[model samples]
Target: MPGIVPRGRRGPEVAGTGEDDSVWAEGQVRTITDLARLAGVSAGTVSRALAGNTLVNARTRERIQQLARSHGFQLNQMASNLRRQKTGVVGVAIPLGHDRRQQISDGFFMTLLGHLADELTQRGYDLMLRRVLPERDEDWLSRFSGSGMVDGLIVIGQSDQFERIEAAAAEYLPMVVWGNHQEGQRHCVVGTDNRLGGRLAAERLIAAGATRLAFFGDAEPMEFAARFAGACDVAARAGVSILACPTSLSVEPMTREIAHHLHSNAGGFDGIFAATDTIAVACLKALRDAGRAVPGHVRLVGFDDLPIASQTSPPLTTIRQDIAAGARALVDLLMRRLGGENTESLVMPPRLIARGTA
Candidate 1:
């Protein structure tokens, strides 16, 4: 069996030779079987060589591996996973409609997803997206975790389902969260210092001589709530009365609501701090419709320096979170947990990107 190899079904070449005429004619090696034929070795020997087993002769193993690498022959992951009883997959869950209006395309979630995908792929883990719709289902995490679809889970947003997440964490599920630091979170979390972001936004508005300020965005999500709380705390100290305007899920309705709030208030607020860049954009449109000049009539600030923030008519000043770093921290924490090491939560600092608005 030194030189004898199987011939491709397409045709037959001279026997007892390492070179398969069909493979040479095709000018490509498609599989380990093809490499085996080319190197005059069996598929098992190729596998052993790729696995770095010392059983195979060093010279033969090195030659086979070099050929495999040159030919770009990848191992059959399905077969490998079957043998190992593991999927090498990581589940990423984002509450798509948890707020009944939020979508996956929301700037923050979209950015987080891109970073997570990149980090996971680089670390040799396949990302499996799981968009949880709390409106339709309650026990989404349990189902995702128990199905054995992934070695660990990374949840993007801790919507109104924090309790459920806590329960899953209590059960010792290997998972990481990307959101605010809650009082009793059992799972590892990687998030921005949202409270400081909000405070910075408010402080900027105040420094610009804004006395009457309004807080835009919902207060249900813990992240937004913390930002709102920070603003309120600073507002209280500065003797500025802060108004609250909850935004709708869609831009149209949210714009209308913001317009109505501004029009009815009638010179009540001199500045506004939006919880997110998306909400900030809606507020800008509403202000324009209401004939209010940005920073001239009412200064504005927003969280998350999304792409659209800088392209707005006058540009938007926003709190910038280290999305890439946060993504890395989440994946790193998850990997540590998977490696049987206890990891701690991480909270990244937020910085204000001052632009035309504030």
Candidate 2:
């Protein structure tokens, strides 16, 4: 599933879970019907947004049209490079990052792009950023196959969308995935040891003498799940009882969603392993608010080691994915493809960043 959509009326919500409420599936196919109804604007607004024209006054219309245009523009930029006898255009398809709203703000993806773009620029290739929402995977196939806007592609998606992306890679284009890609003849992947990260989080907590642990937040993410599973495996070896609770971004970060879990399960748990830095820090906040003490009430460990990790009162001990290393690895593969060399997948190790939380 596309993670657990929270409960709400307008935003991405699951409403009330039952046999019917969940709409997410691993490797699921998406269609325009799942896209927003906001695309129903007049063609004029679409044109303005696409062209970045000031004539479009509606912000929502602008966002929609600009999104489409940015995608098309990048594609054409790729084609334009081919005509010049040297197409510096390197196409990159990043996951939507959020729901239908097209949140292109995934920090790891952004950081990777920053490093990837710098590396590509040094080699005379221009980065063509494309927002590949779930519904547009098929469109990317056709566009990349014939658009000439890009000579190569690097796809960044989570496990939830990886397999669907794999199908397109198998059929067309010179493409590599940024993270754990399902095994296939044509697909290459570069990522860190996610399971190791989970293990590190668990070990950190265990060393601090936490016996009851739970990995929360994106605990359900494939990568995070690996972390949780690894932690669970170790916790089991240590006779530690661990629970994994997943929370969605659509819900308030550290509010009732966490309080509900903590309040209900706080009895024996003394350690928390969060899947994301965002959720981990928030959990820390909630833990304090609920009168639970860190390292005393509970020890916390988070993944990603985002900047805020160090700012939290007790600091955070977490696993750090070498995003820079992953980005460099991706660029190496892309360069190999550009050089007509054999494409190979690369996997890096996730480093553990130790601080006071655990």
Q: Rate the local accuracy (lDDT) of all candidates.
A: 0.85, 0.69
Residue runs of model 1 more than 4 Å from their true location after superposition: 1-44, 62-74, 100-102
**Per-candidate TM vs. native?**
0.84, 0.71
Residue-level lDDT tens digits of model 1 in 1-358: 7675443344555563445445444656766777887788898898899888999999998998899888888787777877786789999998754455555867888898999999999999999998878768877888888776788999988888787888888776479999999766687789988898889999999998899999988888889999999999899999999999887656677777787788788888999999899989888888887788888999999898988999998899999988989999999999999888878889889999999898
Q: Could you give candidate 2's per-residue lDDT for residues 90-127 as a string of tens digits?
A: 88876663333322454555677888888878878788
What are the candidates' C-alpha RMSDs?
5.9, 17.6
Residue 170 error, candidate 1, Å? 1.9
Residue 165's lDDT in candidate 2: 63
Q: Give the TM-score of candidate 2.
A: 0.71
